[model samples]
Target: MNLDTGSSDIWVPSVNCETPPLCKSINKYNATASSTHKQAAGSPTFNLGYAVGGLTGLRATEVVSLGGLTINDQIIGEALSEPTDSYNYPFDGTFGFGWSIISATDQNSTPLDNLYEQKQISKRLFCIKFTDQTQATQDAIPPGGELSIGGCDVEADYWRPLSVDGFWQIKMTKLEVGPATDGGNKLTLCENGCEALFDTGMGPIGGPPDEIELITKQIGAHFDKQSNYYIITPCDIASLPNVDFQFGEVTVTLTPKDYMLTVSPQICYTGFSKMNTKYQKADYLLGDPFLRKLTVIYDKDNKRLGFANLK
Candidate 1:
């Protein structure tokens, strides 16, 4: 599971039987990794609906061998078991190839090859295609598909045809701050420079900043007496907001529905969770929320990401 990303932080889960901490636990895991000078990390405690029983990421060496890499510098621990629900993530575990570099023997080689030749992190991007047809939790995920980073193998993914986007990268135009509606007149979301991030480690695209700035601007422009995240369903305005996605060849238009995080009013900024200001550079990461939206084909061979809308 070698990926070409700037960050090399690995993730694992902390085992706190009762009243476990999610993000805090991951912080602790990072502390441990930093001390060893190893880029390893533990995920916060969580569950996959049933029992916490997925992830089970292989060590760096194991993946190299399996993926037919010439080098084996990576070190992966067996996926450990733990209770979920603390980290706000539904799945059990994640395998991060964030720092994985391609081996000479690897069939799919991206621009990262120049780096690997120079013994550096490849400047390539990758994405994972969640087999929604075979979607499952740690307890019930069907052994149907496999995930490919630098190349594709029927054995790696349970589904076939290998429909994928070449390299995982997109140009973000802007960010939309607020107003979530189902039809004609309401709120919206990240419109400008809102590039989608894709990663196995992240639970969802986390937003942390003066989120209220975005939310309030769009949301406040319309309804007056609603909470921060949710746009007031003004009876006066009988339509949904026009959700917009801007791509070169494809323009995705989704009617604004209730914010994904409809439950919390103030927490609308994150829609899931939040990151600090320093970490607020990237836009809607292609996290769980993202994978669920499309069938991402990662061509490590050519360093391209293929995108297909799933039915």
Candidate 2:
């Protein structure tokens, strides 16, 4: 399952008339079969909105286990209907790590929050390290990443204070593009500061359409209407400039190798895309592409975010 810091509620597809056939291909949580399962009072319905679309489902509680840890009567959503495109991913479901403030139900405590409340963990914190794919060869397995609950490594290189109290948001000071070398000619993409959300659940780095279009154009990429992506020649990947994001005192530089996605032998796509307007509170949504390079710590106690080079 994908750890989603952008949303609330743990959900999996269930056997129902509206359930997609693809749900059978992956793991399903049969609420009816679990002895500890109990329907939520009033059988309240829920609709979870996402970048792709939305998922409609019923709420319930059941025993949930992770590794050797177990939580009884954990709240979960049994998805009855979802977007057809949602099944394309390899994961079975999402384990929401966002704050209880973002939950759909009145009983807003997330599983993680409950774990802390139940004293299963000592700290209200978690850390994530995403596998960097740039080092992978064609058809070769990439190095796996790690996720740690309760606390994170204290050896992080930088720990920046979060600008906002929710959604792991930080204040972005600027964005620049240039060679990785010091004193290189850097082109400013976004000069004015804006809020950025660091989300482990999303794939690409997203922002306003105009900014995305400008950045793509600077990198010699063209928007492909059919694919809804910006395509560039694979050969040009090495020649493209590094994209730098300034988050207060810390600056993260993403090389072409980190921001380009190989679509085919000769074609690649930019990892930056336009975000949905409705969820535009943050000027940018920094996802896996950005997170993969760093060990990110979500410090709920401090209400801040910390980063260090992934070891």
The best candidate by lDDT is 2
Residue-level lDDT of model 1, residues 135-251, one tens digit each, is 454458773334543433332221222122321345544443324432223434454445454454554344543553444344333322344233333322223343344444444
TM-score of each: 0.46, 0.90
Give me the runs in candidate 1 sitting further than 4 Å from their true place: 1-73, 77-93, 100-127, 131-169, 174-196, 211-213, 216-242, 253-274, 277-281, 300-303
Could you tell me the TM-score of candidate 1? 0.46
What are the C-alpha RMSDs, in order, of all predicted structures? 10.9, 3.1
Model 2 C-alpha lDDT per residue in residues 175-249, reported as the tens digit of each score: 987742234455686677888888877878988888888778777788889888888865457678888898767
| lDDT of candidate model 1 versus the reference | 0.37
Misplaced by over 4 Å in model 2 are: 17-25, 136-144, 179-186, 277-280
